[model samples]
Target chain A: MIKVQQKDFNYSLEVAALSEGNHDVGGVCAFSGLVRDLVGDKHIDYMTLEHYPGMTEKCLAEIEAEAHHRWPLEKTLIIHRYGRLEPGDQIVLVAVSSVHREAAFDACRFLIDFLKTNAPFWKLECTGGDSKWVTAKDTDTQACDRWLNGDKKE
Target chain B: MKILYFSWVRDRIDLGNEEIVLPENVTTVEQLVNWLQSKGDGYASAFADLSMIRVAVNQEHVKLGHPIGENDEVAFFPPVTGG
Candidate 1:
């Protein structure tokens, strides 16, 4: 499942919904990303996330499909929030469930790594009445490359 | 073709989306960018640094040499910063 929403989500509720009818699932891995209060002492007051209405969902669905193709995942969920958010607010959640712990862990990692560079979402940081659009870092591209270099299964 | 821009790319170009008939010579993404730069000052400035931008042909990331067609949707934006 993939969700793109402007409202906040309850972590517990989302997880419960994922494992509701699953008896085969032995382990589930969940990752939550939060907005930081400071970006190298800049004192971030808030951050805004923007995405293309139709294209963002399409990109995420592709990524999720790729994850399932590579791993034996019983269930997976991706929830990403757009619009204005303050410090300590949750930005995204990636959860994976599998019968084995290894599949759950690896699939969870792959989902986040791919989403960082592949998804079409932009972030703007505000501090002290000024805001700046964050640029994509080369390090992020490098992180995504690890999975594609040789470990790709499909 | 439909051209779309996002993030600061849209801010610099001053528009989010526009539909244009691709010239006969603009058969690739690289050619399309150069053609857009020639149309107006906003496009020229927005696409001043080609390496700083990323392109997606029909919602999938592609290189500058990727082929484009009249019916395709081409989007331009800064490198993705989302998780």
Candidate 2:
């Protein structure tokens, strides 16, 4: 499942719904991202997220498909929120369920990592009387690129 | 053809999107960028650095050398920063 929305999601509800009728599922791993109050020393008042309407969904589906292709997975869910968000708001959720813990854990990490670099969403940080677009981090791209080289860091 | 801009590219260009009939020579993303640069200072400033821009044709990411059709939807934006 993939969702791109402005409304905040309920993590517990989403996870429960994911593993609801699956008795074969042994473990579920989930990751949720939050909006931080501060970036470096600057206090962020709020953030506005923007995305390409048609392209964002397409990229997310491709990322999810890639994760499925790489691992033995039972179920996967991705929910990313956009629009104006305050500090401490949930920005994204990625969850995976599988027959064992190993696949669930690795696939969950892979899903989020790929989404960070591939998804077409942009964030604009707003401070008091000032605002700027969030710069893309090299670390995020590096995190995604490592998966392609068959190098999984322990 | 429809040219779409996002993030700082849209801000710098002062327009979100526009429709234009492509010139005969503008057959690739590189040539399209070069053509757009001649529009005015806004486009020139937005496209000052090629490394700062990313392009997509018909909603799919592509390189500057990628071929573009006459009716394709081309978008220009910065690198993605989503999670």
lDDT of 1 by residue, A54-148 (tens): 88899899999988998899999999999999999999999999999898898898899889998999999998889899988888888789889
| All candidates: TM-score of chain A | 0.96, 0.97
lDDT of 2 by residue, A69-149 (tens): 888888999999999999999999999998989989999999999898888899999998898999999999899999977
Q: What DockQ class does candidate 1 belong to? A: high
Residue pair clashes in candidate 2: none
* Per-residue accuracy of model 2 over B1-83 as CA lDDT, tens digit each: 99999999999999999999999988999999999999999999999999989998999999999999888999999998887
Number of the top-ranking candidate, with lDDT as the measure: 2
**Prediction 2 TM-score vs. true:** 0.98
TM-score of chain A of 2: 0.97
Off by over 4 Å in 2: none
DockQ of 2: 0.88
C-alpha RMSD over true interface residues, model 2: 0.6
